[model samples]
Target: MANELTEYQQNLVSLVQSHELGDIIKPLIKEIHLFDSYISGTSHLKDRSVLEKIAVGDMLSLQREDNKFDSNAILILNEDGKKLGYVPEKDNIIFARLLDAGKLLKAKISSITQKGSFIQVGVGIYLVDL
Candidate 1:
């Protein structure tokens, strides 16, 4: 069969393709959970107290941070826009690519655990659509 798209479908694709990724409209669909992992470099946060206010199910923001150290760095922030940590280095490459493509991604607090002096904040990354 010949590959084809309806007029409306083709128009939608063209509309989306015309704008930058960040300018594209969010789809009217439920968010998709992509993966779960503990935030890295929590100990290095400027204000570790922000971790205490986090709770399960709280929505967080994912920002792509370009640095000389780790080019794939994705900064995780709290609802108040406070810095939490990062989506571990090994797992950040794909997330970076998705964010770079203008995909809206977020992280939800999944679990929080304390191990001695270390507080591990677990989060579930998601593809969010409005």
Candidate 2:
């Protein structure tokens, strides 16, 4: 898959290797765009205030929620460890599989919209090579 890396990823790899702590630092290589969609069920979060504070470009974390009703459920959380919502079930099958396989993956807020009494969070999921 080395040949498949975009120019951006190549430059990132080079930049990381050139740093003083390059030997130990694991730079994230955005390998692929795994999914792009709104985080589902944000309206259900107890703390809606967190949604208003988050902005686009903020880094988010994903965790597999195996005990959830949906076996493929994945939880989306903010940098502060607050539960934001979830990776939509329809788009989480492959992501869950990748996470279960010990592959590195990450999400970043792509957009945020205020809808009446609730907030909608859009995220871009990417496969990362450390």
Candidate 3:
């Protein structure tokens, strides 16, 4: 048969060709987990030089803990399983909910700053397609 396509297939092809998929499916920055001075495990980061190498999109792992003082506490860890800090209480509510709902959420180190007494690391929460 001569090259042919159904009406639906032709429409889909035209749509794909006409639109930039990147523009349509951009990753959303849902929450920014800013490290607070009171967050546990941060003291260890003071002597650590790894923070300097952390990049914008470096993947961070989150572990939800129900027994923690903050019921919504989510432990943030680096790739090597080193505990970075906890997602700030203010931002953990929705993050915990999303995790409970089994959404494929990924956390990344968005920014890092070394201030007077504490090192501030901002974790960006994103809903990704795996």
On lDDT, the leading prediction is: 1
Which numbered prediction scores highest in TM-score against the true structure?
Answer: 1
Which of 1 and 2 is the better model by lDDT? 1
In order of appearance, the predictions have TM-scores of: 0.77, 0.76, 0.58
Cα lDDT, model 3, residue 9: 19
Query: 28-113, model 3: which lDDT tens digit per residue?
Result: 31334433222345756654665555676788777777654788787777788766777778767776765655544457766667
Ordering by lDDT:
1, 2, 3
Question: What's the TM for model 2?
Answer: 0.76
C-alpha RMSD of each candidate structure in angstroms: 8.3, 7.6, 13.2
Off by over 4 Å in 2: 1-28
The residue ranges of model 1 lying beyond 4 angstroms of the native Cα positions read 1-27
Q: TM-score for model 1?
A: 0.77
lDDT of 1 by residue, 1-130 (tens): 4543222212233345456753546353457999988799999988888988989999998888877899999999998999999999999988887777667788999999999999988999998654
